[model samples]
Target: MPPSAREAANEQRRRLHHEADVVVVGAGIFGCAIAFALARQGRSVLLLERWLKEPDRIVGELLQPGGVAALKKLGLGDCLEGIDAIPVTGYSVIYYGQAVGIPYPLNAGADLGSTGGDTKGNGEKPSRPEGRCFHHGRFINQLRQACAREPNITIVETEVTKTITGTHNPQVLGVESTTRNPKTGLREKGYYFAHLTIICDGYASNFRKQYINRKSVVKSRFYALELIDCPMPTPNYGIVILGESAPVLLYQIGTHETRALIDVPENTPTASPAAGGVRAHLRNVVLPSLPKQVQPCVEAALADGKIPRSMPNSWLPPSTQTEPGVVVLGDAMNMRHPLTGGGMTVAFSDVVILSSLLSPERIPQLGDTAAVRRAMKEFHWRRKGLSSIINILAQALYSLFAANDSQLKALQRGCFAYFQKGGNCLDGPVGLLGGIIHQPMVLVYHFFAVALLAIWLVIKEV
Candidate 1:
């Protein structure tokens, strides 16, 4: 399937019955964007998905400011529009019934996000850049629509069974899929071929174990409850509620719906069925801690008697990509805890970096396995700047927020205290959390500052 400029021009992209220049195995956040990007570069792309239906999930509802910047890079910024998406200015964290506001940095890394502020410099200084939150399915539908409009891209609704590989060598040829025949309404076996195959099947990918050596670590789950027309202490700001137990997250995904995710660590007796299960815990523990205005909404949401749905909070470090003709990416390759809402931010950033490295100018032929492998190596190291910041912060913060030991509890209190100090003490950490800051040393500096402060407070109390 490798082609020269002349061969590529002569090939009919519409005749994509079996082969193409590239095969993308998921139409998710990463899949659609990558397909559209490669197709625009004159590569025939086959975008495969098990189902074309809009996704329904609480994860990826919040996109950090840095993610918005990367979305614009992919030219899919408009996908955020027409969905009644809320502008996220910052976060509201509540510890032991006391609340603090953590706003995005004024500079916000030269204003990376496209929403919330007029930075046109019309004499007004400009507001801080903003992040966004919305219905995950709505945003995904927009991305799929964008892919459908790309001429060189062919969107197929099929379940990718496995990768098709050459017998002589381990080089991936394409994918074997199960597609429903439109005429018979029965799924039939099919195979699609390409020089390059990208597997971004998301957090629950079936292909991940076959390709990567690392495994995801799961310690807790975020149980979800959608609060309708909920009132918040701070408008358009995400809320984090901390107590002696695990932390809870609340954010407005749309004008009418507020998503509430209450973290429950593994083996916590509060969530044990013998202890009256999760409902009893939410009603007795979480409800009382919420703001007076938001309390009623939780009551109403809980009144319906539907058990809360849960998603695992997992973490997996990055692994190098070395397999020829196949690249495993996105959540499959790496994942972090969802506590910071940084998943989409890292996904878009990876797309921005990987797409550029594999761009036509950089690697003229994707079929050139050696050239593509080199680019993947570059991508692994290049993505570390932001991904490392996010991965470390996510796993570490969760440990602090869900502190079960005295030491971690001390660190949690220090974090809340650090936020109150204002200036860099606040902006530096919040900027990093919002994905606007990338300086690892800045994070290290601030973390130790809090640790020192924690020690001082402990000594004073003693």
Candidate 2:
């Protein structure tokens, strides 16, 4: 064969090796979810991941009621249900060593699953589902399995380096990646062209950073540790133990295991391995702060005096989409503290909105710069406010509990006492977190007003 003919053949082979209508980066929950959602819509999708399965990190183990609803919308309840994820009835905010449980959806954990048990046919859309808690690794594997079964989906275990955009315009055309390099034991560099690119590479997405020059704010306060065994029997309840310093959280997972996070501020000696030590700090500083019964679990878990795991509570700022035809979702866009565990749900919510808005009818017209910007504008506007609110609330709660602020501590106690008097104001934030209250800003304002009045009445009585 002629050298020219051989060269042409090699080029043709390279072109055939890479193809897709959409390319999704990061094969974690969000990436697999995007691939599944797009494939269901009859769009060809290629998903790239550095790992085949999602990491079993101390992240997103709990899904809020809203998150449960998002999974149902994507037909994931049955799969998740099979994994033995427990239903989270509500949340309890332990302030000043006092536990006040706020039941989800007016104290009734409603049935909103797709099995028609919790669903109501409004003739337009289905009702929301109850919150669920599962092992992160198990849940993500199920999602990957679902995506892999689809013919229109291709899951590739690889690393994506750069997002390629048009030279003339700033719209993303596809991505460049390394499949498996012979020298590096990874693959050679390759490219995949697509009409749209969804970046779900998490809070540390290279693609997201390349398009927009933003950095993540790293707060090295408390780290997390998971325990498979404890001294006492397991309970259904999860506790948020507030302290004058960094707060701690303890919860039961499954039958015999429990998870705990000892949140020590960066300035505190609690986080220092040499200052107080992890186990000693938990025993002397944190344990004495909790009830006697809870003390046993902490002691038993730290019996080894060496935690098997730890993770810093890091948060990322809101990401802006600079590359057109490319949009980021999930933690890649915005990340809050895991104390709330709403990250996955928030990402899934973005997927639903983006998928609906970017249907064939919309994508074709997105060719224009203004229209492309407008689509992203809507996406940003839709998510920014909510994320900001959640992040602020989570951070505020963390700071309030972790600090030695007499005023904040008093405020926390008074707020719970107010709720005990059948105050409806606290119900709104609960509803908002559960997906029952869609407009969180309005509801929160109302809550604030009611809280102000209640505080005033208490002051007058004094």
What residue runs in model 1 are displaced by over 4 Å at the alpha carbon? 1-15, 109-121
Q: In terms of TM-score, which candidate is strongest?
A: 1
Off by over 4 Å in 2: 1-16, 107-129, 181-186, 220-222, 229-237, 364-371, 384-388, 446-462
- Residue 214 of model 1 has an lDDT of 87
- How many residue pairs clash per model? 0, 7
lDDT of each: 0.87, 0.66
Candidate 2 per-residue C-alpha lDDT over 140-248 given as tens digits, one digit per residue, 9 for 90 to 100: 8888889878766777777888888788977888888888765788468878877778888876667556665666665644555656655322244445666554667
Candidate 2 residue 119 C-alpha distance from true site, Å: 10
Clashing pairs in 2: 111-118, 112-118, 180-186, 180-187, 181-186, 181-187, 245-402
Q: Please name the candidate that would achieve the greatest lDDT relative to the true structure.
A: 1
